[model samples]
Target: MLYITGTPIGNLDDMSYRAVSTLAAVDEILCEDTRTTRKLTNHFEITTPLRSYHDFNKETATEEIIEELKAGKSFALVTDAGMPVISDPGFELVSRLQDESLDYTVIPAASAFTMALVASGIPSYEFTYFGFLPKSNQKRQEKLTEILHHRKTAVIYESPHRMKQLLKDLVKFDPKRLVSISREITKKFEQHERKTANELLHMMDKEIPLKGEFVVIIEGYEEETVNFTGTAKDHVSELVNEGMRPKDAIKLVSELRGMKKQHVYDEFHK
Candidate 1:
């Protein structure tokens, strides 16, 4: 059986007893970084041999691990922090294991996004977790636009260096949109600051220090009443007249009026 384990994001005390036992008992431990995992193992007195299984070597490591599992050897997969296969390595291995009817169980522990959501005091009843944005500027902006369209809370994991740039992009879209920034989670200097994009941009370096990994929780897009004199079909026609594609116009009308896309399409065609 393979074990999918979760490690403490920062605080070692957050490690679960089951996770410790699983790591200790496994024939071998596969980790993103042996050095990072060593700290945890040393603290818990778990001497399971750690093998590198990161993004760089996941393909080959996965095949080798699968063979070992097939040979009746148990292994535990862990990331440097938090849960495995969540914006981290181990997903492909798990999928392959499923195909081969290999058994695996999760040893759940703390996650930065969940911790940030609770700390942010945002409505967590409905939310989306976007682990990390694209590194390229164009792709990142495109993703930001998608996030702007979502009406539920959105959570994003960002590094300290990019935090300011992210806030600047948010300010460009919706200056007054409420957002919560949580950093250094489970650590002594942890912080959760709630403010608007514009406000937060200004507060950077002044109130919020860029030191550790950041989890940004953005409030849902608040739909404002858009006054228009015509029906949905007419709205689509106007946008179409303005050189928008029929399909694009239909989508725009549906989004703007909070109506179903099919309903708008039918009205536009009628």
Candidate 2:
């Protein structure tokens, strides 16, 4: 059996009894960081031997670990924080396990993305998780463009140092886009701020301590409604000047361009 157990993101108390038992019962534990896992095991008095299996060694180490499992030695997999295979390792193992008909199950624990989303006060009914944006300016801007248009909330992980730069980029594109910045997941200083991109950037400059990992949840675009009273003519003329019929212009502008038709009509009339 291959147990994919989750470790605490920050608060040690988040470790569940099942998680402790699974690690203790397994013949060996494959971890991203042996030292980090060692401390967790020591706290719970789990005696399972540790083996390093991380991003660098995942391809080769996974095969060796699988052979051990097939040999009747149960094993547990864990990362430094949260769940494995979630912006982390275990994808390769999961795919291979499914192909070979292996036994595996997940023991879930605290997740930074979900926690940050929930804490954000952002609508959680539907959301897209983009683990992290590309470091390049071109790729990052491309991602930001889609993220701005995306309807549901977007969750992304960013490093401490890059967070400020990321926020600056966001503000440059859309100052009014709301966002939630969360850090230190379950620790004493665990904090989250809900505000627009500009607001969040200012808050970070003022409040955040400049350390710890960050999870950013950005709100989707929602255009504000404008009263169609008299602006309809001007709006219509504006679209028509841009080469569109009064009706199609209003419809197109309102439906796609985010300008109300009545407002367009009022504008044209004027």
The best candidate by lDDT is 1
Number of backbone-clashing residue pairs for each candidate, in the order shown? 0, 17
TM-score against truth, every candidate: 0.86, 0.81
Candidate 2 lDDT trough over 10 residues, lowest sum: 223-232
Show where candidate 2 strays beyond 4 Å. Answer: 223-270
Candidate no. 1 TM-score: 0.86
Give stretches of model 1 more than 4 Å off. Answer: 225-253, 258-270
Model 2, 114-228: lDDT tens digits are 9999899988999999998888766666566556556678999998888888888778657778889999889999898888888777777569877898999988765451222
167: Cα error in model 2, Å: 1.8
lDDT by residue (1-270, candidate 1, tens digit) is: 999999999999899889989999999999988999999999999989999999999998889888989999999989999988989988899899999999999999888999999999889999999999988876676577667657789999999899999998788768888899999998999999998899999999889998899999999876562245679888877655544567876886798788999999998888
Pairs with backbone N, CA or C atoms under 3 Å apart (clashes), candidate 1: none
Q: Give the Cα error of residue 211 in candidate 2, in Å.
A: 1.1
Each model's Cα RMSD: 4.0, 7.7
